[model samples]
Target: MNSIGNIKPFLQKVIRSGVGRWRFFAATLGLLVALVIILLSLQLYLNFNQLLHGKANESETAEFLVISKEVTAENQSKKNESYFLPEEIALLGKQPFADRVGEISSTNFIVTISSFSNAFPFYTDAYFESVPDEFIDIKTEDWSWKQGQVNIPVIIPSFFLELYNTGMAMSQENLPRLSLEALQAIPLRVNIKHSGGTAEFVAHVAGTTDRLNSVLVPEAFMQYANKAYGYQESKPPTRLVLKTLDAADPALQSFLVANSYTTNSDKTKLNKARIIVNWIAGVVGIIGLIMLLFGMLVFTLFIQLTIAASRMDIVLLQTLGASPRQLSGYLMGMFMPVYGAMVMIALLVLSVLQYGIHQLLLQKQLLVSPWLSVYTLAAAALWLLLIWFVNKRTITNYLKAG
Candidate 1:
């Protein structure tokens, strides 16, 4: 405390001069450079992890494992040969790597789709399927179904939408191409027919998924419809959706091969995308490290020059009975604010940048996760410690020579 008081007057006079403060401000620039790199590094790390462990059904990281019985002569003898036997499904459940396995329950009745608020413009024969909600990636408040509610919510495959727009809509001039936004706006009607009669329900498009190649209804709704309209009450599902811990898990492929199961989508493509993302992130990280190294070098050189410029003042203070500890404390007080200011400035800039990025990603229906604030704070603290260490060492060495 006394050391701060001793140097207050001199510090105030020196700080008032623009020329004298130039060196300090220049030192802050190095600090700023270092901070920028660290901020970018944190961002790169977050993006890498998001892509690496992204959802199985997301566009950024598409992961769908649809397993069905392999096409074989022996199995083709039966009408519905792809069905997994009860014991076979039980054995699959025992594997440690399989996250969750759900049956793809098909509607045992017929479904007819039509549009309201417009003429009966198009017609298509469609079947509905459902799985447990846990296997679904796109979560929405509207993606739900109850027994009494007439309106049914459903998810459609992305490729089917593309096919409709490109193949059917393009060829027929009278047919209108439907965009996701447009489809959600106009209401739809779904007719579920049973042996007894037909029931019409209002329908809407909740969302779209790249994984499931079928129109999906809620699990509860599927169960209700099947019970009401199904010819066979105790029939087993022919297709299954397996949610695994990882796409690259060796055990998954080995087990699939052993059971002669076939996949609807290629898992190898996802593995390749992950590899490409890793390479890009690694390159970004290396560039940040290089910038940080340059920052350290600039910081050291600036401190040495500043110390040499003020050598005479340090000597005179020593002659006036100011101990080395007092001089060191005084130096720390003078520079600590600059160090602290740099950190504050850097954080402010990064915060604004992060927020801007978050907004931009949101517009595209994408997500950008924030970095860990505590981790960045720890890094900044270490940087401050480095500045303090250098300041003390330079002062102690100069004082020893006197």
Candidate 2:
């Protein structure tokens, strides 16, 4: 440390006399800009990945899609075409995009739900649908049923409550607006009518879901009721619920269109937007890489120029017993601090930008971390090492030639 400290000033004077200060500064500025662009592009790519695939951005039910046959004019009158055949279900399950496919089972018996209280007097014929318990978003202990259980739990669509509150209650003189809590508190009489007779069960809203647009019941209850009350043979499902990692995959959309199937458009609407953003990110990253290569080349050329101009001085110093290793070490020590400072400045700028982006995305209900991703940090370190290697090689090669 003492030797390095004593020799540093003399080496600085010799190198400074040889290299133009303005040229060195220009090369450094270019390197800094290139580094910043590379880091920014990496950070942006990571941010988009978090928004698209991060756990914080995933809803419990977002990966599930309820698919059904498209109701076209030609197929509207054909009852058989409306239901998916056994071969069709098997083929759909074999699709690469579908992790698993479960049929949406409809009630085989007629169902009627009526308000139990006189204050909210209402009676309407209703349909019940059931899917596997894992697919249901509402997690509750009450979402279970067995034989002889008088109380039944049901999950309704969130829009049903919203429509009643906004449209129905506003127009009706006596009907009061019901919140989710209030709706869950009220009991309704569920009547199962079949060829045998009528059976009544007390039912209450266990929860509401925004994922599925239908009234839901426990799979156990639906299977039992369908077996006991259904007068005809069981029919194939008209709809299917599919589990997938990416609902916005274009291949999934193309398959659906080719097969004349349809699903909730809201779930797959991000397809185009995601594709466009990915393309833009890719292009930006390529541009940054090109800039980084150019910056590295400029730094190499600058080091070569400095060594060439100071060849006589370097040879005299060697004759005076300054080792080649010492000279190389001094050159490295001189430039490494500046390179480190550039990296720090780039990271600082990215951190601030990332924090601002996180806040902005949070307002729109999208999730992203305020900190830089590990991949981005690793990339920065890798680039720094690459620059070091290039600079070291250039310095050693030029000094040997001198």
Candidate 3:
């Protein structure tokens, strides 16, 4: 302790004089440059990854369907075709179905339609006129189907008018008529008798015989039309849609499938890929941090070597009663300003870059992800530990070499 106290003034003089400045300056500059390059590269990589994820989400949403069924698993294999639900179910819960499921339906209808000419106003006009003066009662409409709705809208074929060659022009609103052109045809309409004593509406129209003449109406309205036209009342669909649950979470998914189900997102591969990319990013980050630490180590080592090589100067200080610990403190203190500045600058630049990225990707619904935070903090800690280890080792090496 007395030796260290005696060494303090001599060690302080050496540092305060700022000897061998150029080499250390060059090494520090090199570290800063490397940090800039690494940060830029990582930012670019994550941006590209985010764009890819967005496109994948869009594509997957477009191509799947859903089915909800109540039958047991044994029934799925039964050869009875009557119990088999339609293979393609449209959007589940909105129109064709409602917005409930996410599939397309395969059922199609064909029919011929004739307008009432002067005998009938246009179909659109006819329907519009039926509404009350101040208030209107109409079903919400959509071009596609989902599930969970009581009624669904249908799109009529565009070729219907051309095929009939019904030269007579009629109300654009009510130009076409519907009917069965052949026997065994699914009724064009179904009659819906509300449980009320007398109220009823015509709903869904099944397939017709002719393709060009088909008309589309709400499922409920078609039923009412069948009854008004003396056809049998539309019966409830005998079959329900079914689909298999994937094995990943078979119990819960299977139960949901039994009730109302659609295609499940297969996220195993996606999750695996995410882990891999993050790991790679982490590795890259670690490498950059390692390089930074190595540069710092090299700088410390270079300073220590320069001091050791100037043995005559160290001996002169020793003659002046300098102690080892004070020499160590003196050497470390020489770089204090540089270390502090480097840390502050690195943190400041990173904060600005991250803030800019956040602003740019905000509207894209992009996020850094929670895991990114965890990985980043872990990386920083690892780098700090590496730096500390390297710093200590450099000091020890200098003392031994001396």
Candidate 4:
């Protein structure tokens, strides 16, 4: 109880003296720290995200080729007539490094979601959640990114609805079931008349990549459409897609050459480029870190100067029998308000930066990970601790010098 009474006077004296004349400098130091933290956080996020996407794309490679000519038996006799096919090669990629054997198929078309109109609606039947404007798509393209989802969309039969006991029974076992909530919120509506008397298919949502207003269907639907729509000749694919299991630099190159197939070295080049880019980014991160450290050092020096200017008063306390423990606690306590302000300002600044970046990505329909929030907060706290320790050392040195 007596110790508590003695500690109260030291705390009061520190608080009263610490907030003396340099209020503006303390505020400016804090603001600069906040700004530096924000910038570092944003740059780290951008670079990290870029690396993730680039690495993902790099793992799966697809070979694109255009057929220029075809040889035939009749051409040996006189000059056989040559014709072109409409199908394109699509290879679903598998293991990239050790086992490269993959499945190959022909796709009628690549359904890339290019852009969307003003009203983008949600799907009720989809188990996977959708974020507005995110680069998520349901594609017939054979790639790792396009797998795992049911791409072949068919009409939600009345029978499917009946299975759920919604009283719209048709045939429970034969039809595909979807939620009525999703059906009502369908994103696209268009009549696709088939070529050979097949039923016209319609969709609730449209693909965004193509300016074409229709929702994309699978190869079966396209074939059905061609027969009904009177497409005369079927287009043959130019080349077969090759998948390799060995992703080693030398092995990949050798495999392509041995097969007499030409491939672009772009993926290899990009990986190398990232090494340099990441190094540069790391250097910039370090520089920002140094600036933050320098700012804290300047603030600590100012605090030291303040204490030195009041050295005579400290000496008077020592003469009055104030213990060394009391003097140390008083000086450390003075910094509590400054450290608290710095931490709060850093958090506010980082939050605003994150919000702005998230909104920008949302408008552009890009993927933004929420994990960035956790990373930024962790980094800020780490820097704050470093600054606190440095300030402690500065106070000790100042007292010794006085």
| RMSD of every prediction | 9.8, 4.5, 13.2, 16.5
**lDDT (0 to 1) per candidate:** 0.72, 0.84, 0.43, 0.46
In model 2, what lDDT does residue 15 have?
68
Clashing pairs in 2: none
TM for every model, in the order presented, reads: 0.52, 0.77, 0.41, 0.44
Colliding pairs, model 1:
none
Segments in model 4 whose C-alpha atoms lie over 4 Å from true places: 1-6, 9-27, 30-43, 50-280, 370-372, 400-402
Report the C-alpha lDDT of model 1 over 107-215, residue by residue, as the tens digit. 8888898867555365567889998987887789988888899988889888877898999889988778989988777677788788889988887888888878888
The segments of candidate 1 whose C-alpha lies over 4 angstroms from its true place after superposition are: 1-62, 117-120, 269-402
Pick by lDDT: 1 or 2, better one? 2
Best by TM-score: 2
| Backbone collisions counted per model | 0, 0, 59, 25
lDDT value for model 2: 0.84
Best-to-worst order by lDDT is 2, 1, 4, 3
For 1-402, candidate 4 gives per-residue lDDT tens digits of 224346666546643454346664665576466446555544554645554463455645332211123344545453223322232122212214322221112223222221123343222321111111112233423312122233334223244434454542234544334455554344442333334332322344322321111232443444543444433443443332233322223444444445333433244334344455566667776666677666666677667766776777777766776665566556766665667667677677656665676677668655455334565666667766776677677766766665
Model 4 compared with the native: what TM-score?
Answer: 0.44
Across 84-190, the per-residue lDDT of candidate 3 in tens digits comes to: 24332332222321223322222122222222245443222111001011111123334222333333344334354334334433434444443323211222222
